[model samples]
Every structure is written in structure tokens, then in C-alpha cells.
Target: MTQTVGSRALSSPRELTRVADRSSFIYLERCIVHRDANAITAEDAEGTTHIPAATIGTLLLGPGTRITHQAMSVLGECGAAVAWVGENAVRYYAGGRALTRSSALAEAQAVAWANQRTRLDVARAMYRLRFPDEDPSGLTRRGLLGREGDRVKDCYRKNSERTGVRWRKRQYVPGDFTAGDTVNQAITAAAQCMYGITHAVVAALGCSPALGFVHSGHELSFVLDVADLYKTEIGIPLAFDIAAESDEDPGPRTRRALRDRIHQLGLLDRCVTDIKSLLLPSGTQASEITVADSDIDRVSLQSDHDQLLPSGTNYGDEAGW
Candidate 1:
């Protein structure tokens, strides 16, 4: 006797049905497809036609490119972010998921609250570092002494202008906008690149991407937090310099340089100790291990093994079991 896996017939050819898979995937630089009518279609390298927009998780359109409304709609329906390359490489669209009401509210609240707190904290820290000999009360009474935002904007503007790029006023509003020139495009590209990288880092650490002390929410919380910390301090300045220096269009090379600058600025080295830590066994003793740069690699390894072992299982337990 033959056994059946489900309620349906196993041997009947006429009863067979094809199930559609709507999972999303990403399109890399080389996976883009172009049309004879000055349009482009993107898919995997296997030459599959009519790449379902739903299958696309994210679409990165390189510099000097365009997409049709139909394609954009498909991507939107499928919940994908369309990142374009240009002077201010911008996110043209953030798909359906980005526009959800709950997500929007959460994101807005997170950003606003985080921004306020971050501004205060950053100001205090900068004040202490800049004027150690000065009285703290005097600095507090001075009322908004540091001009970090202005410094960032001015540095960015100068660098952009040097590269023949001009940007409109900094619009903190979320979503996509066109870059006025190559310089503006470069700055936007660098910023988004940092955002993506930071999001990935937060995901790898098993932390909610949306839900930040400086950035709050159910979507991109941690990414927003990390971006808040770096954008004004590092990203803005780097974008300015990159815009000013590179004569030709800055592509992958520019991205690499930007990432290198982030590292040079020690962005990742900064400690975020707000997250709770788990106690780990060390011989007969247990110690609390917080997530930090030094412990990131070790924690990542342990996280991988967490599925096979219980939540509280220690590193040494693996050897016995």
C-alpha cells in the first residue's frame, strides 16, 4: 500500500496543481534587464522573463537609469524599496510595506523622540569633550552652544559645491526625492548605503531593526538609531568630501571609500549598552555578557547554535552533548 502525504491524490495526474511561490528576492548590480524601448527589466542571470515584482525584495537602479510606472507599481505591491543611482542617489519608492499606517506612525514617533534625546545627549557629550575646563553649569546656561547640525550641513554643502553638486535644504521627511545633481546624488547614495549596512548589522545581531532609543519603531528601529548617530557626525561630512573629490561618477569605489571612512571614524566601535545581556557559564561561575564590539563575533557564533541547544545552554555544554 502507498502512503499519501496530504489529503489530495498522490498518483492522479489530473488532480495535480502548481502552487505559486511569492517569496521576495534581491536584484544585484548585474541582474538588471533593459528593453528595446529605453526601459529596463531586472531578473536573475538565468534569463527568466517577466520577473515577478513580488519576487523582488529590493531593487537598486544604477546611475542614469529609469523604470516604468508599471514596474514601479509591481515593486510597490510586492513591498520593495527602489533605490536609484544619480547625483543624489535616492530611494524613489519604499513599496507598500513602508506606507502602512502602523509602520508610518511608529517610524515617525521613533525618529522624533530619538532625534530629541540624541541631540541632547550628543550636545552634552560634545560640550564636555570640547570644554573640559569650563564650568558645566555655565555651558548648560549658554543654551545650545554646539552647532553640530550646522557644521554637518555646511561641510556637506561646501564639499558638494566643490564637486559642482547642489542640494536642496535638508528635508528630514522620510521617502524619496530626486538629486539635483551628481554631487547631491552621491551624498544620498552614501547615506542610504550606510543605512542598508547598519540594518544588516542589526539584523545579524538578532535585534529589532525598528526600535531605537534615538529612533523608535516596528520598522528599521535599530537602523534609524545607528543612522542617527552617524549621519550628522560622519555620513554628512564624508558625503561632502566624496562629492568634492571624485570627478567621474562615484560608483562602487565611492561606496567602498565611504564604508572605509565609517570604519576610520570608529562608528562601529561606539558602545550601545542598552540591550539586555545573558549570563554565561565560566567554569562554576556565571557572568553577564553584554553585546559590544569585542563580543559581537562570539555572540554571533553562539546565536547560530542557539537553535540546537536551549536558550540558557552555555558554550561548554556543546562538548558534552
Candidate 2:
């Protein structure tokens, strides 16, 4: 979750001490400010403090949280991004650097390519999973097969129609398909969480988040990869529900609710597991890909009422694998 700044402000702050050469700890009180340091320790009001440079992949500070210049410098040297929560709880800060021993540019390019391919593969897999009975060969036909541009548009339309929400005039123009209100809000929330998570993962792997495989935008490459996987099912549906409940405008509470729903949807956990399986060395085989039949049964039971119609409720059950 991203941090947010509250109304409380600080009074007097202290100067940060440099600890680049040695392992040092710093403490943070309700009112204490220090300069960025090369390496220093820190403690919170609860007495829970440490030199995070050694362990944290990304450091996120809430509003009212203060750091010394010495600590900031040390964090930068250690290749950590210090993100701060704004008054609106949005995260804003800097310090994601490429720390490869090889040429930074070359490493960034390689990573970007690999990440792009990975994202595409994941997108294809998710589409196939969502529509297992549909013929893949027909997906590209002009009249029947849905194009990427059209698919995005259809996703917006279907979501908006399903939720009864209208898009702001400038939010989307004629022929310029923007994600609908529900999906857009959900996307924003997911994007925020995914940004920090992807950055953390990239940092742990000694890669730069700015140098993404498929994404080229300055501040969003890595998060873009994560979003590509999320939008297909999880974010789309969750956003639709949120839009349905709210009178079209989703506030922070709605975003929080959608976030909780995403957790229940299990997309992140499943995606992480799938990625881990893909990244494991070739020799290591995944033991199993299991889906609980009980869950399917529960869904089927819940939908039994609609099956009573004259249509006979086949629901694609006869489609062959």
C-alpha cells in the first residue's frame, strides 16, 4: 500500500550525519529532520528502527516522516528509491538508479526487451485463460477477431455499460477510447501499488525500474509491465463493481474497497507464482497447476437459478479442449 501525508506538520528538524563508510543507525522522532546520508540507521516512535539500506528494496515514507540528508545520500549510494507520501497520499519521490557493473545503458536495453516479451506472453496467456473455449485463430479476423485497439475499447464500453457510469467529456473523445470510469479508477489504484512492488522487485534483481522491457515512458515503464497482466481480468472487473456502487466518481474509499477486492480476487498472488515458475531454472519443473474444483462448483451452484430458463444453460460446457 502507498503512504499518505496527514495534516500534522513538523517544527524543528535535525541535520543528518553521514555514515558512508561504516554501518550506522539513525532514529526518527515525531519531529526530527536530517539530511540525506550515505548510510545511517533510523528508529521510529515505536522504537522500531534500523538502517534500511541493508534490507529494504524500496523505502516509502509517509507525510510527517523526516529523513536526514546524510541518510538520503547513503540510501542513494545503496541504490534505493526514497518515495514520500503527498498530502493526498500519493507517492512522490526519487532515486531509482541502474547499478550494473556492466554498461548501464546496455543492461537497461536488455532488461527492457526481456520485460516486454514477458509482458506480451503474460497478456496472451491471460486472454487464452479467460476464453479457453474460443478459437484463437479467429481473434485477428476483421469482423470477428478483435483487434488490440478495439479490445481496449470494448473493455471500456462493456465495463461502462455494465456499471452505468458515464465518462467525462475530455477524459475520452470520439474514436479515442479511454478506459471507462470504473476500470480507470481501479487502474489508477493498481498502478500505484504495482509501481512500488515492481520497483522493489527490480531493485532486488539489481535491475533498474526506469529501464523497462516494453514500456518506454520516463516514470512508468516497470509498472506498465505489471499493469499489462492486471488489466485483463482483475482490474477490469473490480473497477466495474466499484463504478457500479459509486455514483460514477470513485473516491479514496472506493479505491481502497477495490484494492481489497483485488486481494480477494487472488490475481497478484497467482501472477507472482506464475512468474516465479517461469523464472525458475529450466531443469526445475513445476509440480502442478491446481485449481480448486470446489470453487467451480460453488459458482455453478450460484448460477443454477439462471439455468432454469428455456435456453437450457449449456454455458459452453460442451466445448472441447
Q: What is the lDDT of candidate 2?
A: 0.44
Q: Mind giving the per-residue lDDT tens digits that candidate 2 earns over 177-240? A: 2343444554454445446544544443344455433455666565555445556465555656
Positional deviation of 14 in candidate 1, in angstroms? 51
Error of 2 at 70 (Å): 9.3
lDDT of 1 by residue, 1-321 (tens): 342212322211111100012211233454545322212255545662444443333355665444657666644433444555434343332423331211222323334345555434434543444334443343341353344344556666765566555666654433443423445555566677766545433432334455554334447655655654456556665665665676466445456677566556544334122111110112312112222213112212224554433344457655554
Worst 10 residues of 1 by lDDT: 11-20
TM-score per candidate: 0.42, 0.47
The stretch of ten residues in a row with the least summed lDDT in candidate 2 is 11-20
Cα shift from native, residue 32, model 1 (Å)? 11
lDDT of each: 0.43, 0.44
Candidate 1 accuracy as lDDT: 0.43
- How high a TM-score does candidate 2 get? 0.47
